[model samples]
Target: MLSALRKYLILPKLIRLSWSAPKNRTVAWDRYWAGIARTGARSDVLWDSGTDHELLAYRDVLRRHFDPSLPIVDVGCGHGAFSRALTAYSPRVLGVDVSPHAVARASGESAGVEGVSYLARDMTGPGAGAGLVGSTDANVFVRGVLHVLDAANQAALMENLRQLVGARGTVFLAETNFQGNPVEYVSHLGASLRSIPAPLELAIRKLPMPGHFGPEELARAMPKDRWTLVEDGAATIETNPLMDAAGNSRVPGYFAVLKAKDPDAGR
Candidate 1:
């Protein structure tokens, strides 16, 4: 009875909190990243165990698919961690973010790194990158960014990315899917409720951000004719302790590889 109540009652409330979240996602994330920068903490620390593992997996995928000679763009590159990682494969890497503090920190921390640059710009805007649009082949990397935006902004960003990449471009995306696993969902929900204070928890619900989405939700959000889902799968990055007893330990998330559908359609 208790389990059923929690699943049917508490779970629905938690899900509703995400659905009705605020819409100013970009600004909220900018402030959040700025705050993190001010605290002198590396942005990589914000990644959970599952995310870290997924990143490693993605790196392997990148090594296989990435053309070493072409330039790579790291969209929503928070602190240049992924950009620096990409440097190992491609000499030319550009990291861009909307947060000035994050850009400053990334630039300062990676000052000595060669062939890698950081910029503070909103990729969704018209005047995002000067002289960057047609300078390189479109092979963009986006991690934990899409879900932060509302539907309109997400669509706009996708359109912008498609434009930046031009024809025959590829987009590698890593995002959290709350509907991936039941055990993982319950575990995360319990942890969040415990870690956050009551008032702050309420505030989070009102924050202008799409907390997370399911795999289907994400798939539906993509422009069908503009983008083709080439590859996708669950992120078995970590084990769920709650499901250990059942010998099922995989946590929930997803990664996808999308290609421009028409290659020359947007151009």
Candidate 2:
């Protein structure tokens, strides 16, 4: 009875408070993630049960597209889940993130895991791409990070990836779409709602959320002069039985594969 009351009644109030909350997104995310680090929790623990599907989808993409012999760089890799996963195939995988706590936790968790390492570095900073510059065979993988950045930061990130991957390298990006239908929105929200207690979820939701972009907007955001889109399509992160207007299943996220137009142009 109390659970029902909190879910139906108290939840609405908390959601409202979350909308009105005044918090800097970067600071809030750092602090929130710091708490996760201290607890030594796996990043997936924050998501609903179905997040495993998304992880599987990512693994599938990697298997089909990623070259095992080439170095792999995972940008904005929180807690190094995918980075650690890549160690099975690649001899060199570097996961970089802006959060020191996240990097430290990831490094500690994956310590002695051959072929994988974690670094605390902001992709947007000057010379941040220096280490990976001119690696024509490298691949840069970014997921669940771009939508959170502003335009300038996003551009900087792309530039960094371009440098890391070089002219012939490839880039894979996965991001949530803000223009999803009501069902899609609910599906995305349900992940958090199911995993977190009602009141706490509500409080967390009130904090500043990340930005979302439609497919066209994402295409426009890419640096056309440097990268050429190879493939892009709707991706289902969670199974939804419902169909959209086009009779296709609704998905909460999307993915893109881009190749450098000129691998040796800016070097």
Candidate 3:
């Protein structure tokens, strides 16, 4: 009753105010993660499926592509889920997020995990990847991140990724490709107008609305002149289990493997 009221009536207004405010996406994300880390558990996050099935699947896809000797960086890694998973593929892993609370939580959860660390860095900000610029080219893993940003921020993030990966490393990105409006997307995921799920509600009330990302969006962000597409195909992003569904909820998604073209080659 009250939950339904908040989702449909109350939260819509609040989310609108948040959209209109001068807050950047990083601040919104910081507040969202901080709120969850303070009051909720991992199971409360919708996209966190509480299982490693998706990670395992991606591992298979990346096994042939990633160099085990190179370090891996997980961007937008909430609570270090993928960061911990990347250890199987690399000797060193660094998980970076915009929220300090998220970094703290990831670091706490990753206690005793060798060669794994967490840092709070907003990838869209000016000179965001400066601290991470190193001689060794790092393989990058990003999931469900680019679509949330507007065009400019997406470009900024790509620039940061360029710096992080340098010329020799590979980059893999997976993103949700829901081709509908917010209400339609939620409804397709088994939510009704009056009976929105709690995780979905939390996302609605706090986080930025997620946009779709497919091959076209990827091409725009990673131009052909600067990047070489290695492989890409259809994929699925798993979400938390839904009550009426047979298993965890699944969303349509895509993945791409790319390498930065050598600058000297074009010149």
TM-score of each: 0.73, 0.74, 0.87
Candidate 3 stretches with Cα past 4 Å from truth are 1-23, 37-42, 243-248, 263-267
TM-score of 1: 0.73
What lDDT score belongs to each candidate, Candidate 1 first?
0.62, 0.63, 0.76
Error of 2 at 115 (Å): 1.0
RMSD of 1: 5.3
Task: Extract clashing residue pairs from model 2.
Answer: 18-206, 167-263
The true-versus-predicted C-alpha distance at residue 199 of model 3, in Å, is 0.8
Error of 2 at 167 (Å): 2.5
Best by TM-score: 3
Please provide, for model 1 over 168-225, each residue's C-alpha lDDT reduced to its tens digit, 9 standing for 90 to 100: 4578887766653432354443423334333223434544433565466566667687
Candidate 2, superposed: residue stretches over 4 Å from native: 1-25, 37-52, 132-137, 178-188, 191-207, 238-251, 265-267
- Model 1 spans with C-alpha error above 4 angstroms: 3-23, 37-45, 48-52, 127-130, 180-209, 236-251, 263-267
Best by lDDT: 3
Better of 1 and 3 by lDDT: 3
Write down the TM-score for model 3.
0.87
